[model samples]
Target chain A: MLQKKVLPRLDESLLTHLPPFSRLERRQIRTILDQATSRRYDQGVAIFDEGAQADRFYMLLDGYVRVVRITPTGEQVTSLHIPAGQLLGIAKAIGRDSYPATALTATESIVLSWPTRLWETFVREYDGFATETYKTLGHRVGEMNTRIVELATQQVEQRVANALLRLINQTGRKVEGGIEIDFPITRQDLSELTATTLHTVSRLLSGWEKRGLVESKRKRIKVTNPHALVVLSQG
Target chain B: MLQKKVLPRLDESLLTHLPPFSRLERRQIRTILDQATSRRYDQGVAIFDEGAQADRFYMLLDGYVRVVRITPTGEQVTSLHIPAGQLLGIAKAIGRDSYPATALTATESIVLSWPTRLWETFVREYDGFATETYKTLGHRVGEMNTRIVELATQQVEQRVANALLRLINQTGRKVEGGIEIDFPITRQDLSELTATTLHTVSRLLSGWEKRGLVESKRKRIKVTNPHALVVLSQG
Candidate 1:
């Protein structure tokens, strides 16, 4: 069960920095926020499930999300990891009435959501909404295309390396050693991300750890040598 | 060498049925056509190359286009096939100044293009333009997601089967024996699409031919038994 917390007037400043709201006036931003309700979710909570009715759409205000898909045989694949200040569950943007994939929280997160009925109104009335939304969609499509090419042409090792590089680039935090993927991601997650087996992922990670390429412990991974991983990914 | 053909006038009916133009008024449609130049591309002609300047965007009025991507190692992969009545070279929509992939003509094609500068105007002025366009991008993303899942979970035979089914669904034409893929797709192309070796693709197709599931001859293929393919794809 999930609980929605009543928002006591979302501040317009909260959205001014976001790309989709950057061009809108304060009044416009206020109007947009007025229609939204905010909620807090714990890490590992599912925000939505695949094939469920897309009655609402959401924007992540804090933390990370894992976009997951289940194959026909019921195998789970982690399709994407989305950072904060991004929209999710926009099935209307994709011309579907049902959610296409499941969105799970990779970290404890805060989110604001609006009824799906207001989607078209927002697109039409909001100044930068459509352009920014489409731009985001385009970026996702480009990423998917890159992943497709990787799957088709790259080896398993290269695929895994590229996946790590992508995660670090998207949500890496600088630590003492290097850049740490700023969320809890397990070896099974990496295997799903790279389309490789868990044993293969374990073997490769162990080898890379020995070579001082990465450090993994307790479901967390940090890249100690990103340049080496880049080189490995290029092959 | 490429040649641009001047149009005396573009018929409004030519676009009335297209999704992007369907919601525009007559004068609005005329304004759009006025900004566009029509061109005829011969088979195998490259409409746009990856990483090249995206100065213009186009819509395929007739025939087909193949979206190709070259890997870092200079290997060609057929990423997608676009049928007529669809948009291509939409780099601007993706926030890209350069095309992300090369679009090659699968057959002699008629295309209408406008300067990239007009993309924003179209979205702003034309009703349903942004929505329809994003919907199309969403559909592509969905397709790419499916492909990624197939690559991750399916065997070589299953991947090949899904690829054929996708092609036939997009541009298949009913023929005497069954439905023929309307484009000239070689086994090498199938190999690229499915991320398998040419030898494996040939072997699988031959085995399927023996089983009366498909017919391949002279750079063309026909699905003789789609039901069997659905079964094969499920596994």
Candidate 2:
């Protein structure tokens, strides 16, 4: 229904840079864009909830969405963040009956969505799209395998160092001191990320700040010594 | 090519139960079976090494394969094990240039392989195959997300309990004592799976045995009280 009420067609040019679409030829991109409906959300809005019927999936045109899951203990953990030009809610597109996690907009965001019914049609028509999409999923599984290994073998200090390094790699902004994480993340978020307590994350950041290895203020973090962090993460 | 070596044709009926193949029609299954090559490996043999050039992916016909990744510190960790009827080395078939982990035969195994080049051909021709394959990958990603959350938030005991339950669900055998994990898996494997230490896993298993929660000897484990594990994993 959103498709029928679209104000104006999304620029076909934006589709050229997204996965599945990026793999599409010009005409194939046009065909998909014709069926897409664009929507915007305010920062901190829930895009979809866990256990919701998975009828559609979204492609981010701008901004960020964080995937959060509530454990059996009722603690919420943000598992991953989706950046611009990437797809989310892919479980539905691949035949899952419901979403496994809640997706919340981390910032004011724009997303282009398509009904799940069209997923097979696109795959049947475009080999590149399906291949690229599945490849992305495979890469994610590989990354999580690495994280599991890290959590299993590494010390808390090392885990924190690794988490910071990964964050910087994914969304770092170069600054005078070093590379600052480009997202608004708190110590609580860092704690959830590194499998540590908030106190532990705070202490580690403080110690790193004292050594000029990192700079932190409020919700922001900057890795001042990337090499040192790498050395520490290796432990 | 293995298919041309005439080692005898793979059983077409087995293909009907495996993914992608399972989604295919009888005629389509025969078409794919014609291109598949059956090979056998001895227990502990390396099926594929991490970083090897992508060429082919396999479907297990018998036995198991353990997916192992070596850390930057030279520690090898077994990330997961794939039992018969599941697919492996799928990254290559989905556009990745190389295997992300080393896959070793956990037991003497029979596998049917298809060259990566034919992946696109199958997807373009078979909507069922593509949908099923991508669905499998999506399920894997979802599983990993759950593991990541557990590692990030759950305690070591809880994680161990969760891992054991998951393994039993995947490959449990009913026994007089309880539900036994139907595979050869050592304490070291348990340690790696739960992100704990060998000593810790040993100690925890011993403590659980004293409490009549589980029974273990060498590489085998039996859950005498599955309900306890469920409660523990929830913590």
Candidate 3:
């Protein structure tokens, strides 16, 4: 069965990283992409809201967005930040008809949204696309498991540190002095993102600033000592 | 898009519950049944451990099993105790090569463990299999979301009531006096399942026993005043 190798030649780099889309048959994906439409979202715009009917799949072209779940008490908990080149609104595209969470534009962004039925076409005609999509689903399941563990076991301090490290690792840019977080995120926003109270977050930031691990001014945060931040992640 | 109708039948009664498979699709699933190899476990048997390489998925054939996770401090937590007909060890079957949590036998039981690769093959080769599998995945995602909400907001006592309610919903048996829990589970196990200490669990159980809301002795528990239990859940 392995030798049959009916699947198309895969891009080696993608196979080892990201979803298993590396194995996709190129011609099939090209056809689907030809039918997709792109649009732009302004900063602070609602890309979609919780309980909204899910009917389209979106792939980001530029900028970033936050996927958030609003608690019953009206508190918003940020689950993930989606950046350019990543897919959003997958539940809509994957056959479900309701938005799982609200998507808020973190910056002005370009996105490609395709009709949900287009996925059916891919699954029926393009084995490679379906295979890759399933692989993406698998990756999401693993990620959720990790989140569940963290939510269940990790202390608030560790969760906050992990959130900071994740933001820096994914979107930090090096400047003349140190690495800075790209987004104009506030401490209250960071508190919601980490599922902790703002008071604790404020105290932690103050502590970090005193120790010279990070610098905070206005709406910006800069990481002066990545190694020190890692040590703080000790659970 | 509404005319596209991904699920063609859309029957009120069936979709409201569970839909029947296409005849050919049922046959394919039956073949998975043919390949299924059953194993027996006596009570208290540890079926798998968290962080173990995920290899196989299990379908309970008889009796019951409990899903467990151990904290960093070596405290055991029981996530769920489920009976026959429900799937177990599914984390590995979808994509993970390793199991996420430990499973223990709640009673003398039979389970069918299948190679995950083979399950994937069945999902691909069989028509409508992918559709059904995706539904299962969606259902699990919904269940996880519910767990997340509970962990985030619910008190420990509320959590225990909810846990018992869930277990009763899944596997309880009707008797002359009340609903039998249908599994031999101790208060310690209940504590683990609810993410609290055993002493707290014992205290709650004792309180319930005094109120005649439940009957408990050693490893047995029966819900007598379900309405009262619901009040406890609310309070």
Ranking by TM-score: 1, 2, 3
Q: Which of the predicted structures, 2 or 3, would earn the higher TM-score when compared with the native?
A: 2
Ranking by lDDT: 1, 2, 3
lDDT of 2 at A189: 79
- Candidate 2 on B107-201: residue-level lDDT in tens? 78888888888876876787577667667666766777787888878888998998899888887889997999877888988887777778999
Chain B alone, candidate 2, TM-score of 0.92
**RMSD, every candidate, angstroms:** 2.0, 3.0, 9.5
Per-candidate DockQ vs. reference? 0.66, 0.56, 0.21
Q: What residue pairs clash in candidate 1, if any at all?
A: none
lDDT of 1 by residue, A1-235 (tens): 4455456667888899999889989889988888888989999989999989999999999999999899868888888889999988988877778888899999999999999999989888888787788678778878888988999899999999999999999999999989999999888889999998888999999999999999999789999999999999988
lDDT of 1 by residue, B116-191 (tens): 9998888878888877887777677787888888888999999999999988999999999889999888888889
**Candidate 2: regions farther than 4 A off:** A1-9, A23-31, A125-127, B1-7, B23-31
Model 3 TM-score on a 0 to 1 scale:
0.81
Q: In DockQ terms, which candidate is top?
A: 1
Q: B52 in model 2: Cα distance from truth in Å?
A: 1.1
lDDT per residue for candidate 3 within A1-235, as digits (tens), equals: 1122122432233222334234455564455455656566778788889888887777676788888777666777776777676767777323467877789998888666677766677566754555566555666555554455556667778877877888888788897677888878888888877667888988999998999988988778898988888887767
Rank by DockQ (best first)? 1, 2, 3
